[model samples]
Target chain A: MPSFDLDSYLQTQVERVEQLLRSRSDEMGVQVPPRLLESMRYSLLAGGKRLRPVLCLAFAEAVLKQSNVPRMVEDCACALEFIHTYSLVHDDLPSMDNDDMRRGRPTNHKVYGEAMAILAGDSLLTDAFALVAGGPEPVRGVLCRELAVASGSSGMVGGQVLDIAEDRPAHIDYLTRMHRLKTGALIRAACRMGVLAAGGDADALARADVYGDSVGLAFQIADDVLDVTGDASSMGKPVGADAAAGRFTFPAVLGLEESKQLAARKVAEAIDAVKTLEPHDGPLAALARYSVERRS
Target chain B: MPSFDLDSYLQTQVERVEQLLRSRSDEMGVQVPPRLLESMRYSLLAGGKRLRPVLCLAFAEAVLKQSNVPRMVEDCACALEFIHTYSLVHDDLPSMDNDDMRRGRPTNHKVYGEAMAILAGDSLLTDAFALVAGGPEPVRGVLCRELAVASGSSGMVGGQVLDIAEDRPAHIDYLTRMHRLKTGALIRAACRMGVLAAGGDADALARADVYGDSVGLAFQIADDVLDVTGDASSMGKPVGADAAAGRFTFPAVLGLEESKQLAARKVAEAIDAVKTLEPHDGPLAALARYSVERRS
Candidate 1:
């Protein structure tokens, strides 16, 4: 119905990426900070779509061979996921979302308590870079730059600043800008990094960046839609929480009908962005559609 | 003359370091998140021995003819200090150390509240890597690895695990080992990074690491000594707070007299570690003495 089986394809690729990341976690089984490592795993392995890492992998495959990034990619993807999880953990704290449940389980602060939740989030964010930092100097250096750009001012964390400020405002421009940085920066980085890790070309990187940016916006809008118009049981968390926050979102600003149309337009742009690449056939095509159409 | 003129030397260097950090806080300038950036400056400019960066500069001179890190040094040094300050902020959070004050001001969480404190800490930590990432790839890569090792499980964070787990009672050897990883890891990384940044030889790196390790332990003991013997006035924070938390220290495990003796021995080892370098004098020697004796 959506011109492709988005769910099965995404689920398959996401599983592959998750399995790869899980392997790296096993290898990083260092001794001293056993509990620290355990806590990291608790948050990391908590099930999600693995969307970010798969995008990284699928993009890298456009340039690199499929099997080339077994070790490095896992750590890179794991670090990104850690950043995402840490944000969710902190954002759900009483001072923020006051969410008690996530991924159908107790939120980190709920399970670990507020203090541990705070510390756990802190450690995960710090360790995200540290995870990549332990590698060879050149690769680690390049990877650090890639990740720093993704996570810093012009990237995900910067978006967070705008997002919090938007809780009161109703401006569409501010909302788009916030969504660009908050969600788009990391997703773009993940795509670009996949190329970097696998020695992809400049052209590929540029195209993927465009694709990732478009889809990142589209994906967040989908989130807004699900939040307002989703089923609680199927979504695994509260659906209308965003509206309840009286916060900015696509639907909040553009109305539900327009929000859906905008998401589809962005998805179309993302698909067209990669259409020129001959090697961009499999996962990349599937990914653009999945970004817009996935239910969860 | 109290063996060495540590007070005068420390005063000038600490002031210089604080000044350097404050000015560079604005280097990323108006684009940075205002409150988050201000919080970063608040902690970085807070007075302390600029031991980490000084060690960096010392090792830079000791390893090569640079005499000082280039203009870029300030940004990177301040970045390292930011990482340190962020760790302290998070460590002192309710989930971690639960300390109420740091560097004479209400700890970040106390002033900004927990959510901001957590985000502030996350901002600093991520931005630290962002600074390095944006720098020259080769230098940034090596520096990133050095920092990652220090910040992660094998280092400071790992030491933190040992700190909390060892909070009750454990083998003295275990406690000491934990402290080395926790505090010593980053301090050692700071020195090692100066060499990496300067493109020095293995021999210089080895000496710096050894010196850093010994001085790191001595620094902790001086902290313990101050916890018991110094005042809240000079220290700028509550004294005897560690004992209240049931955390162990050199004085707690060994008597005050024995702790002082051990401190002296560690200092001797630190001095010897760096003495092999050609033509060593001034700040490095003064720092060794200061590490064992600083009141705050």
Candidate 2:
């Protein structure tokens, strides 16, 4: 009867993710060197939108038509977050993006030395598998495969390579392909993993896959738009760095107006795809809209 | 009727691992960017002893008492090699060990650039899980857990942190613990994963564990001895770099004679532990001896 307040939903879910990450770090065992653990916790616990984990949990809830999803869903969500954090840590390294600031604070390498940051990222990536491997059988292997395939050379890492390539073509198709692999792959995995974790049927999984594809592209377009138009304070990192570095983004490839229109259309597709899974004005629809409308 | 020839056994296993690595890279999908795939293949196909994969396959054969292990065993073996290769790539990074050469060739970064090399290492690590996750259901999860835990924060990465720590204690216990995690964990996993993939019983797994622990320690001590006494051409990498960097190695902590004695003792322990798992003069015992006798 009441309206589904997306803000409150996100806050509650973010808190849950934070708690899980904290507990998981604590449970990493006494044998985990203190400094390595500290470096890992620093970026892992650093505040972000928690987009991947939230999307994973949301899909699970929507598929089950209930809020109380299984522990497998939580495990999948945590693994997604861990993978996301590791990517960020590595992407921000001096040899990569050379990012000095992230999430309104100094990057991992700035706080911990570059070597420790690399190890922290490595530990996070490895530990994500450890966490998912502990999930209940049948689905656990699926979860591991999903997470790995989405993040490995053919996916996120592939996207990174394209992004940094000196001879990349400047075309909308190339841009789309790059984003699809880099950011879209993991986002899609998050949604699909949620469905798998909740034992959703084939139809549900297919719908989730469609919804994820749309939202993932939309999210990257929105990110490109924000880099051009949004303020640095809200984003926690400098704006326009992508353009300055001559990075191929939607706004750069297409006109700003065209990019915005494409994002809006993609969001609409995302919402329509998830209609069977949730009500018209449900969190899924709201999230699609938020993908483009969010300031940071 | 023929003697267990360690040389021929290693050559045959190494070839199998190399073939798998090549095929796996080819099948990573065309969606994978060319540069990323090239970088990944560079270090992955680069010749080493293929020790981890060979060890994994050997244990699987020893447990099954046949040369024809399952596809799962091969998959786990490749995964182990992938992890080992990734660790080497990262360890050779400028921010980490800063080595310009590895396996008698230019390091990954030298060929592919630093950013590409990092991504290559990352892709290798993530794809390792993907490889194992494709194994048969229940055992796949266990394989994932074993590989992850052995290579994660509480294992190899943790050991790396200790190795690089500025204030690390200079004691035998500290050195042992560091090696136990960094090198020993993956070696132990190599043995255990082989047994699991072969569907060996718990007792077999336990024996593999003991054998792994002893050989792992012996391997490190031998490595330390090699660094101090072995030739660079034979070892592929420069010798005495560890001592030059003031690394806490066996030869540095204990005297050279004491380190050699300790290695011999560990090799004896390793051979003794595996007597129940393999014939008295089997490949397992030969491998234990090889752990100390190898030039590289």
Candidate 3:
């Protein structure tokens, strides 16, 4: 097992983010859509690792150890998860994955119908910006530019759009492009924005971003491995679902042995990326190893 | 039968918007998602009366005759239409209206998958900010503030969210609340933003907002009327679909007779609201009358 205490790190960040999302989100006149807000909250607070935002906060704090970093980081962090979960919600809809199960429950659309699911995704994505716009003005532009690029066409949206449309035979470059934009953008943003929020730690942020990119890619590759070898009972979700969907996964293209070698390479790269950072973020370095090496 | 030439006006705006949309929306670096951009363009260029953005620009030019407005005004105008069309695209998705037909073609999700459709909506919506953010510093703040409110929870997204989850029988207040937020907020922004972009007289901007509120409500009322009476063939969508969806609409609560009366009253108010502004923009006042009274 990796030596990282990410679970504890996640616990503290989740509490902080929950408070931030609740206190900061209220507006003066508009009554928030209760169901939408409730649904978003349920997904966000639903006991996941809180990896994305925690990584963001950790990366930001690694170099510029200020008290205000956590104070200012929640909206951006939670908003990343909101966008991620929202995509998951819509992606699982019948027209796409048609999966009834997610994190061991029927997906939101299955419970709420398609319109609410669609709108939930829409609301979550927009609420992300609204959250950023409401943040302190200094970092607002940087956050907007990064998050928008990550979430919009150039990043996650672009990758997913191509994922849906592309019937071409699998290529690493194409899949890597998709992975970096779709899954990796927000992950990388979490680190980069964290550093930015800490009031300009460019070197630390760049290092964090390297860690993020390598880990994000390794995370995907590990999932492809898990889908190939993971047991359905232990995986929570079905195993081999990606293969069933005819997805061009790492193991499918590279063979399991090659995929494992690539995963190991990425884990080393992710760990090495942040070697220059001080020992205070030792847990984060361990996280890089866990990302590629985890079985479930 | 309305005095103004609605078809020709709509045609002119649509042509201009289509021309603009075909060009790349200038972003700092991230490549525009090919499918998302293509989908946005497909819907943006899809036929609709460019009333919202037209109102924005026409009033802007009418109010601020300072001769300093940049071509970005045209882009802002195009941006409003993009926002409106994006909402419609998402609203028409299977998870929402589940309608296959929109403007006589397949709805975006019907053509693109649900994930891409959601992203396309998200892309277009956020891209509106990118458009406004590109403007001069003076106007960007006003543009950002106004667009954020209109597009965010207090405005369109909030209303649509409520409309989807209201779980109520057809109720007048619910319908009004939904319409005001879902449709009226953006309409109000269209008028308000036009004046803001032009740096128009403050009083004129307020009056234009009043005009927008009235015309916007009247437009909804007319849509409700069309829901009962329009030819699906000519309307290019399912006319009685609202009733089928169990949605609370103006005509359902007001009764057809009362709904028509209310629409006419609102149209008169719209005309009255804009009449304060003199010879500079006779066309806008004329257009409001035409927008609510159009048979198609």
Best by lDDT: 2
**Candidate 2 lDDT, A145-197, residue by residue in tens:** 99999999888988988888999899999999999989999999999999999
Count of clashes, each model: 4, 0, 4
lDDT of 3 by residue, A84-178 (tens): 87778867777666788877677887777777777767666666766665666556656755776677667776777767776745888877888
Could you tell me the lDDT of residue B59 within candidate 3? 78
Residue pairs in candidate 3 whose N, alpha carbon or C atoms collide under 3 angstroms: A114-B95, A115-B95, A115-B96, B94-B98
Ordered list by TM-score, greatest first? 2, 1, 3
lDDT of each: 0.76, 0.91, 0.74
Better of 2 and 3 by DockQ: 2
What lDDT tens digits, residue by residue, belong to model 2 across residues B1-296?
Answer: 76789988888888888998898778764668877888888899989888788889989999899999999999999899899999999999998899999988999999989999899999999999998997788799889999999999999999999999999898999999999999999999999999999999999899889989989999999999999999989999889999998878898889999999999999888888888888768988988899999999
TM, every model: 0.93, 0.98, 0.87
> By descending DockQ, how would the candidates be arranged?
2, 1, 3
DockQ of candidate 1 is: 0.59
Per-residue lDDT of A110 in model 1: 76
Residue by residue across A1-296, what tens digits does model 1's lDDT show? 23555567677777876786676666664653676677667777888887788887777666765646645666777787877878888788887668898889888877767765665676677777877776665666777778877776556766776676524467778788888878888888888777776667789889988988998999999999888888998789988888886777888899999999999999989888888763445567778877877777
